[model samples]
Target: MQVIDPVTLDNCADEPIHIPGSIQPHGALLAFDLEGILLGWSANVAQLLQLTPTLNTPLAALALPAEVSQAASECLDSVEDGEAPVTALEVTFGAVRFDCIVHAYHARLIIEFERRDTPSDAVAAFALKAHAAIDRLRRQKSIDALLQLATEQVRAITGFDRVMAYRFHQDDSGDVTAEARRDDLEPYLHRRYPASDIPAQARRLYTINTLRLIADIHYTPSPLVGRAGDVPLDLSHSVLRSVSPIHIEYLQNMGVGASMSVSIVVAGRLWGLLACHHMAPLQVPYSVRMAADVMAQVLASLVQSMEARANALLVEQSAEVRTRLMETLLHQDEPARALLAHAPGVCQSLQAEALIVTEYGKLVVHGDIDPELAARMVASLPAHGQDMVERSAVGDWPEALRPALAPWAGLLALRFDPATDGWLLALRREQIHTIRWAGRPDKVIRTGPMGPRLTPRGSFDEWRQMVRERAVPWAAAERLAASQLLGEMHRASVAKHVETDRARAQLLAMLGHDLRGPLHSINMAATVLQHGGAASTMSTRIQASSTRMERLISQVLDMSRINGGLGLGLTRGPVDLVPLLHDLLDEARTAHPELRIDASMPAALVAEVDGDRLVQVVSNLVSNARHHGDHGEPIELMLDERDGKVLLEVRNTAPAIPAGLLPTLYSPLKHASVGNVRNRGGLGLGLHIAQEIVQQHGGEIVYRYAASQVVFAVTLPRA
Candidate 1:
């Protein structure tokens, strides 16, 4: 055998692994038609069969014994569609004994004759060992423990120097989760391997052929001799199929002489593999291989059950936490406080070092975190809950926040509102660990005739690297708990507001009715004083106070009526909106000489609306713009008519409405701060009244924030 160059060997990975067209010399293969005429045979068949068989020769003409021929035909008939070749029967012809396996392939019956290597007495011992392994597996309760037991049992049964349970990640990369090996050998447990190490074709073959055995890595491949014009054989399910050259080279690089792998399948999918490797060339009897296959299947079933149980426990714990948190929130006066009250249990449930709850404009800290740092982390969280749970290393966080967050190396932050600085942060302290790797992960390349070629790394020596600036990974359970917590918080918040609104409405109605008589007397006294001109300055002050009081009282009555579902009385007429806007703009310019107002009005746009109500709506919008608009930019007012509807838009380059404030912008008594001035308000009812009046006239009012500007758009029916 010649050593193939690295580039050529690497390219061989692309070759169809299923159709190797060769078999190990320990086996002889023969292909025949359904009518029992020989179509093809392996090159070594003559040596095994002790006869020269012509192509297309009928079964009756061949020198094969009657029993072997009958068994082959029956096995071929028993093979279902898409099923792999199976050992049908054993036959001894002229002192040569073989196990004959028959399968259907491409309109032909393929029979494989493998010489049995195991003694008859070994079968009973292997069966007993299999039963013991299955009993041990049944006693295990967790997937990890079961995997450990499985690898040990396989190593004990096969007498392999080392056995490992390799589990794959979602990306096809694998990790050695469990290992049983000689004391002198370096451990491969928890060592990771890239997906490229096992090419896609190799993975597919593992599924079709659940068990593969390479007795000797350096064995020569015996070619199969097909009839004239026959295609290469597809030896995908062949027990004696020659292994890939690249895989053999890989094993050699790992200082392995022989290797065997049995696929662990769950729910009809390949879950992982029980991979066994020996320090020297070794072969196990086929009986042991069959027993190992059964053990792997049992392990697969147990693993699935254990994983499901673990998930169920997690869900149960999460539900309990959610229930307690909701109960606390529903009864507590302060929702943020309620979150803090449940912090200890939630922290334990989520497996976090600390938990932070930032809601309702208050920051609540739970454990092992700086209040300032937690606040910053909450502010940095995105507003959307779609990616509500963000897990990252502290070092990877923003540079400004890194120092404060560094102590907690891992951060898992979830936001109830992506548009607001309200979130829940789970922190995990910095973790440091030393990882022992099987070999240097770096690829070794050769500058060959091809620009570059990859070669297997030389040594399988253990390499250690100290890793830091990271945190223990967030588990799936923690993420689930966080999502559940967020949902409960949102529900509680809505319920709180609903209760608050109902109580407030009742108090307002009582206050409105009680204050009416007293307000009437004050108005009468102010009117009398103004007419008599007694204490002229006092008279003027009294009249202005009375007027302001009357406006407040009227707004309260309007709110009460609206809340009671009483429709607003609207007196509609064809009113020209252009003139109304111009008059309002003029009034605005005169009232605020320091501000600039830009107006674009159509010549004449009439709409069916109450002239008084429309004027009030325009006045309220203009006033808001003047008071809350950005000081550096002019307010823009546009009125136009198109497609039988009137469009009135009032836009101002203002400090944008804060995301947190947008939801309450048009709610009654919800005051918005203008620039830096807070509470510069006239009861906060201006926008609310304007919205109600517009809706009554069959119009729609909407507010939009764009380019650091606030725009109020009103669409109404044109006269």
Candidate 2:
């Protein structure tokens, strides 16, 4: 047996585990060029095939059976360029039958030959077992359940003393998540192993070759030989590839004489491993290994589906929360207050302990946290680069700030503006617990011929450590949700600013157009009257312009007072609608003589209301109707009382309001007709003020389009 000294083993990371230069003695490996010129052959090949390696020797000279040669050619042709090995082919060479697995690597055709001599009965039995195992794995609904089922099924099929399902962590380290073994053996479940245990090259090999078995650690490696040169063979896809000496030593230290590992691949990446171990040298049949490989593939597919489904659901939920938050923020005047209002929902939905929003030197915190410390941290955080950062452990944070953040171990933060120090941070509290490790996980160095070499720890005994100041790691879903929240917040802030700027511009325009224009006309008319030029006409124009200016000013004041929370100061009294309607009809006829006016009402319909405010509501509604109504269509008003409620309808023939603009019709200062078919503009508060007054009287004003007519409908309690 060859014992690699500590120096060679120490450089395990640089070791080319893929090109071991040798292979297990039980199988033969052959490498040839595209023209059938023999390039390389394992030392065991001569004994197995009665052929020796020679420079530029054609593979056909060996006289391999026609069927076997054709199968080999077909296998190579079927494999696409740069793809993994194709399925193995059963072939006969003399009296020995073998499974011929062919693949191309670095412009060389490499073939592995594994001897197969199982009886027909054994083959049939193994097939049944393989099918049962696949069926059992398929029934598992979740990734965890599937892994557990895989471990148990592989153990039963391979008959190994211990079987464990090990999963890789984000840091390349791995943990034994599920295990099934003999009752007397120690359990390896939940035990974490350092990344160094499996070298980088070894991990790459695991992805290429899904199943690997070491039937006997003590068996000698048969070196591949060529006619000339010192070129080594590449055994990357060889099932009977020789084991790495360092790995052999590690297994020996752990009292494992034989082992088999099957890679669990998800979405083309190595996700984990199903490792089988035995205390004594044991040979696992090729059939059993094949069955284990099939099971691993099936499990990998199921895991991918489950994860995809989970991610979709999380995305949908995050979108809903984002929509709700944006709607609330758009309606708010202050961003800080808006975020505070939805703080609880945000925290709960994100599964966070606390939430913080810091902007422009202002800090608002929503849950358990040290406000002063959080403020300091927020100020110190980067104001550029990545928009989001998530960390499960904050141990590397500054020592000065550690005490303040000691209670929390995880953080998810999103910056709304990369150029500004504005952030939305979600916090997670620290979790302290005990964890079991397979060993001390500390690398050891030993003196060797070449200075020293790093080696795996000598002990496999369980080591218990108390883990502290570490919170539950933030999952990909939570990070995605945080990103979505930041996007929505940014949009809301932009929209609010736009709306604010627009409203300000509109107010300025109202002062310039409605107030200034009318006042200027009146002033010009007064000058004309003073000069004795058409005094009657100028005087009439002055009176009409002044009245229009007064009405505009009064409406502006009413909207301002209502928005400022001032009560409308209504005096309840017995008001007669019939007399009021008749007076309003006469006034409308005088104001808009070109259009006809229609009114429907009871002879004596009376209700308790503020006579002045109710009259103002009616006046505003009637004026709006006359201005926006079709030029040739009559304006209609209907008022009635039933079931202790007063119903009022103002209808006119006009183009239907755009669906998108209808919701904003009752909003203060919103011009629903800005770009519509009719653009007669005002302060845009006529319907707004009317709706406010009716609500004060315990009523609602609704606008709807029906039968080619636009209608303003108000329903009020008779109070």
Candidate 3:
């Protein structure tokens, strides 16, 4: 009933599993130097090969089979350092034949002789079986199907009693996802095993060596007899490397006499394992194990493909949701409010239960989340440079917030604006579920001949536990989607800021130049009246200045309303264009005596329209032409009907607008600077307001520049 000490359990991770100092009893190992002199041999090599071993003896003097000697020489010549063992040749000793596996390690040529149990002709059969298995696996459309097929194929190829596909989780624990076994054997599918079952060092070796076998768990380990000062031989890549005693005891407790594992590596990481177990001692031939290894690799590749495809589909869906959210942000005056309105959809896309949006330290939550708890969670999150932070376990959160966050164990926080502390957090409620572990997942310390050592648990009966205070793990696709949404939010924020700055600069410009002119004229007229100058002349000047100031104020108000998502307040009525045009021309002529204006129109042309709003449109267009047009050329106005629609065209001779500025030509507060001819005494809202008024009347306004002439045409549908 002794429990392992915490320190000793931590020390287990540093075990020298690679240099085990021995080989399994199924094989005999021999180590030689470059000069063909024997350096080390396993203790049972004399009994296995019937050849007495001698230290510092030349290999040729051992009187071994001629083929074995030649094959060992060729292997030493061709094998590179640190390479995995290669099957060099097959030779017979007395009546039994063995396969020679050779590799070079640390200036020594090591060879392992494993008994050849399968007939030589079985090699071709194994090759054909592998090809068929891979073809069948390729036909599977999902990871589950592929895993099931893989386990079945490995069992079929190796004749093991049980084969299970054990997939590793983010926590390093594993679950048996798929299984193929004899009818009398108990099922292990969906059973979980703790990370401590496979220590860190053993997992590292799994990545280095793709296949490992324990032919007989009860067999004695043949100790290597090397020179007095030599270090323990590194069996990291050895096929016959002895199994760890802890692992051996664990397998024995499970009633497994033999076991083999093929590593499933994806993108250079150990993704899972193809674990095979037999009820009795089983020696699988090297050729057959190679076939199983190939299948395992194929399974890894297929799993990767299936996962990538699913993730891609999720990303596409998330992008659609993001596009809709962006539209809301751009159209509404308050972006945070708009986002909160669509919180449910966002949460669904992110696979979360609730959403929290924070702007300038104010929190707005959608769903059944408490505002106080949400605030605490946000405050407790450490400031990170990354735009997105994801946490699934309660312990992963800051200690101060863990107690409050217990109910909501998962968090995906996207920081859209670091300056304003704006964040969009998606939360998942704690999901309490039961796990069926193969055992209690605890080990004990036992004092044996090797001193105090950590031993595997003796019992492997099914054990169930209820796990709480943890949420279901988030998928990679969800994180990717969150990151993408963060990027879009950042871009939208920058655009909003740019527009704000531009409007601010325009407002200052108008206040300094446009309004000051009228103010100065009114002031001068008032002073003259006060000093007893001609009252009629001073009154006329004051009236003109006051009218100009009123027009500027009206234009500013109109722009503000349109920008606030409010359309123009238009009153519809029928109005004749001929008189309106004539009267407008008379005023323009009187106002600018040095300018020439020309007009053409059909008599009595009229339509359903907002008369006052139409007047503003026409007046703005004429004033824009006068200010920006070439002064030497006559301004032309035409009123006519075309294609059953009323067409009003205002033409002026001016240089074409710059290409870069054309896109923003009708945007509020954006004006063109053409060769120092500034927009004299007017805000840049004329065209934008004109477009809005025309559209409100079910018409469209278009601008064209051709042959040094700028034309703005309003097309109104005839009622």
On TM-score, the candidate that comes out on top is 3
In angstroms, give how far residue 621 of model 1 lies from its true place. Answer: 39
Model 1 scores a TM of 0.64
Expressed as tens digits, the lDDT of each residue in 369-427 for candidate 3 is: 89999888888665768778888888878887877775799889999977667789899
Q: What is the C-alpha local distance difference test score of candidate 2?
A: 0.78
Sliding window of 10 residues with minimal summed lDDT for model 1: 672-681
Question: How accurate locally is residue 621 in candidate 1, as Cα lDDT from 0 to 100?
Answer: 87
lDDT of each: 0.75, 0.78, 0.83
Better of 1 and 2 by lDDT: 2
The alpha-carbon lDDT assigned to residue 673 of candidate 2 equals: 41
How good is model 2 by TM-score? 0.70
Q: What is the lDDT of residue 645 in candidate 3?
A: 92
**Using lDDT as the measure, which candidate wins?**
3
Which 10-residue span in candidate 2 carries the lowest summed lDDT?
672-681
* Positional deviation of residue 381's Cα in model 1 after best superposition, in angstroms: 3.4
Every model: Cα RMSD to truth: 18.1, 10.3, 9.9
Give one digit per residue, the lDDT tens place, for model 1 in 1-719: 96755564345356577777787777778777777788778788788878787888887788777777776667666666634356556666568767666676556677777776666567558778888989999998778889999999999888899999988775576789999999998788998775667777888888877999888888787776756125766777777778776578789998898899999887666778999999897767676788999999888888888877887887888788889988777654345556787887777777888888765445778887778777788766655545465655766677787766667877777665333245777788888787655677555666656455565556667777687778877766677777777787777767767765764774465446545645665666677776885566655556555655666677777766665446467888888778777887787787569889888887888778899888889887877887777775898888888788888889998777777776556666553432125323266677778887887777879999877789999998875
